[model samples]
Target: MTNKKRLELTWIGKDKRPKLEPRILLEDVARSYHAKHLVTDNDIFDNRLIFGDNLLALKALEQEFSGKVKCVYIDPPFNTQQAFEHYDDGLEHSIWLGLIRDRIDIIRNLISEDGTLFVHIDDNELGYLIVLLDEIFGRQNRITVVSFKQGAATGHKAINPGVVSTSNFIVLYAKNKTLWKPNRVFTARNKRDTRYGQFIDNFDAPYAQWRFITLTQAFARSLNLPIRGLKKAVGDSYEALLSDFVVANAPRVVRLARPDYDAVSGDARSMIDASHKTSEILRLEREEFSDMFFVAGERILFYSDKLKLIDGKYVAGEPLTTIWDDLLSNNIHNEGGIEFPKGKKPEALIKRCFELATIDGDLVLDSFAGSGTTGAVAHKMGRRWIMVELGEHCHTHIIPRLQKVIDGEDKGGVTEATGWKGGGGFRYYRIAPSLLDKDKWGNWVISKEYNAAQLTEALCKLEGFTYAPSDTLYWQQGHSTERDFIYITTQTLGADQLHALSEDVGTERSLLVLCSAFRGNPERFTNLTVKRIPSTVLSKCEWRHDDYSLILQNLPMAQREEETLKKKKSAHPSLFDNQDA
Candidate 1:
């Protein structure tokens, strides 16, 4: 057997991972919005809209949201080599890959075992993105690359010099392909199928007594038109009139085709053979399927079977394909009462993603939420969603757009299709300022931006505990489990204070205490493990680091850090070599 491995798309800083600060999220209740009352029983009001760097925002969400999100859709700013109003669309290729790689790593963690991810990009970095995602999501888990035709190459676009680029690509991957449940989505057609032109005049009659006639003659009779003068009477409207009639009388009008005898069941084959042998019009009834009718060794297929309910109308439909050209972004500039111009994705496009990957009340996440299209569409479709945006427009654009969606004032973009009467809400949050900051003395300290409660919550996250403070118990600021608890305070603790906390915790439970400073031999208090706050967490992460990025300039710094780690391991060999010991 040949040993094989996935090929990686390597670039600068691919190995150097960030010691990310899992900062806490602080809600801005004033910016949050909801309807006065519920529009429906299933309305969701707990969606999140985070206004901060998306990478950091995703980190803030992981502790609580990991393995929970059902679908993630990111329309990330790519290397377009052109600047837009709300985005820096161009970045160095290596840096872009690094940026995407960091976010993708966290995104995979957020995706549940049965969840999926979809990313929209053009051809420029499509090859690299595909390889990167394949390596991360596993080659076998990749679903498909959809060629989304956003616009037509007509009018001004047709006059362009080279092949006009009216379409980009959406790359899809599942967290675990085996566990994913794909909803069979279909594409709808506006008109009826012409093949179902034969009508059964005696459909209600018993077998061997049925009569057949042309559907056109039946339709003419229904319209009280003379069979010979049908074309002349309808004139230019003949096709439209006939199409409406066929759709209305779809069950009676059908096209007969020979069934594959080898593929059909024995009972159906018997009926088919009987119909051919005599003047018998045979029929077979199936509980899960429509009754099958045989006529001269052929199966009658009804036009109604091809119809699908699309946008409140039943029209002909086919299984959706990878090449999607129906979702057009035309005249949607004023949609959502704001404009991000080049960055705004079509609501229909996001709706398609949700329909494929989610059901009602599923959680959806979009980190690169330009114009909040994902949230807007998810709301209409009744899926709970969280959107993160680093741009100033998170307030200027997203909040206002969502308010309109909840208020029922926005009447465009999927509202009609989903029949949205609008009643859901979202809270506004910003990634709290990095936990630690430099002071006047040039020492790392907890920032003044954090109150006592905020600092306790932040330290809970850093210490790998859920931030669930108990109202009755002061020491139970958070907990990893019911038996394990943590307490945080800005005040220094003495032997007496430690004794009080230990007694409250009791021998049945354990508490990890974090404070400004602690005195005495804390090991004596069997259940308490006291440690200094800023000192204990100092070496755990890069303090005062508010932003995370992988840039070309940092390559040498990464090298130096790698060398330092290697030297430390060499000095203490057992620390690196023996894991179980």
Candidate 2:
């Protein structure tokens, strides 16, 4: 009999190798919501909530949204070594890195030139994640690290025995920092409180009583008047006389005012007198406050506090700093170190980021949308959004939450505190399946479930083509470039089928088709360029063989102590360095 140990070793070796086609990691089916006769319809709004793999969904979005998004906020899996209830939560550190690497690479491509990206992470992988972000987003594109309080309690046993809680990190990266800035709108309360201080607005001076001063010396100088011993003659009313003299000189000239306009409207005069009258007025002058004003001699007119009624100019203050003071952490109930549920995000967090980095009507995209928080907040802020989620939670949690927001029923600090009362709607979509599949001859054939036209549309979406022709039955999809049309075929096309496809492609123009065959006639289809399948589609999938596990396997076999030290060194070069190598 063969040795059992050798057989076990062979089995172990076989099991350790990666699979070619891994099982679908996160799968949740939903009914079709947008596609009508293979073209976008006006019935569907610009905003979207996609329930599917984020990577695949991003690929799908390439057709409609690449380089169009203005802001993106993603709180991806932080590889915290904790189990996740929704997915294969725990991955080897290297595997996690590889996964994030691919996803971030695609995300970087999706960002417009003026777009910004905000990523939330914990201490577990923050440094490594930063390095990865630098590699994908480029070091020059880094914005800032916004620190947020995660939890303030450390369960009585602190690592330092003094520090009680921990803070989370948000790493922001922009496509081009110099090209754009976030927009801010001041609140009416802040304006009234003057807590932001006395800054100029429209170059107008403050309308304080001191600014409208009545000078006795100036009055005496006017019309050769003398104020010598004026305290005896005019008494306390000397200043009032000066003011009345200035008012007579000024005369409240109404350049553009209607000739028939009346500032002495009976109702307005009564309201102003009633409101300004005080106990001091009653004590000083027995006459009512209304009767005290000598309207005939002085040009005194009651002015309401409303700025709209004034004829003054305003001056702008210093531009606001993009960083906001609000945090979204409150009552976040979860055991796996995840914040909120799979389909919920704190509104305050999104509001802060948007207010700092984007303007109204900017496009916001969140790929790993555990909850539809980003979309909801973007909607409330008057920005458009594209949300991608890859779990059943997208339907049960995200859809209902967004529906509540749309119907004005949600009050979870989002609608009530933020004052968001549903004004727009979103179109929902599920990631369409890949169009191409191998046949007996390893040849490309279109799937029967999809007609030629449907296959053409799917190919277009897969290959970054935004539109397809409805009138003609051209096998190729729309042009991304002048000579290229996104083309896809399920089975290998034979010589005759290739000729037919070429003839349909037309002789006048060349075709850049993405297919499963390169054996077509070069002379007849001289302008045609063929990109094979699997290569085109695999880039959009989380191919595990190309992921972190393979990277970790490259490391030489070493003792546990050495491996730990290596990881620590990689994680924190600032902490550990110059020790004996």
Supply the TM-score for candidate 2: 0.58
TM-score for candidate 1, residues paired by index: 0.91
lDDT, model 1: 0.88
Q: For residues 1-581, write the lDDT of model 2, one tens digit per residue.
A: 88555111111122232222211112232432322232212222457887766766665565456788888899887665555565444556655665677667777778898889999877887888887788677777898887776544645536565656356778999888788565553312112212111111211432221123234444555536566866566678764554444334432211111112255656444533553543211111224443222221222332112112111222212333333333435443321123454324457667767877787678889888776678777766678888887778777667776666665566564454455655566777765444445469975344455565655566565455645563565454577766556556656766677676777767666665666655756456665666666566554533322223222233332245588988999999977676766
lDDT of 1 by residue, 239-310 (tens): 888888887877788898988899987789799888898666677989998889887899888888888887
Top candidate (lDDT): 1
Q: What stretches of model 2 exceed 4 Å from their correct place?
A: 1-44, 87-89, 154-160, 184-328, 331-344, 438-451, 461-467, 473-477, 482-508, 512-522, 525-581
TM-score of each: 0.91, 0.58
For model 2, what is the alpha-carbon lDDT of residue 132?
75
Poorest 10 consecutive residues by lDDT, candidate 1: 549-558
The top-ranked prediction according to TM-score is 1
Worst 10 residues of 2 by lDDT: 303-312
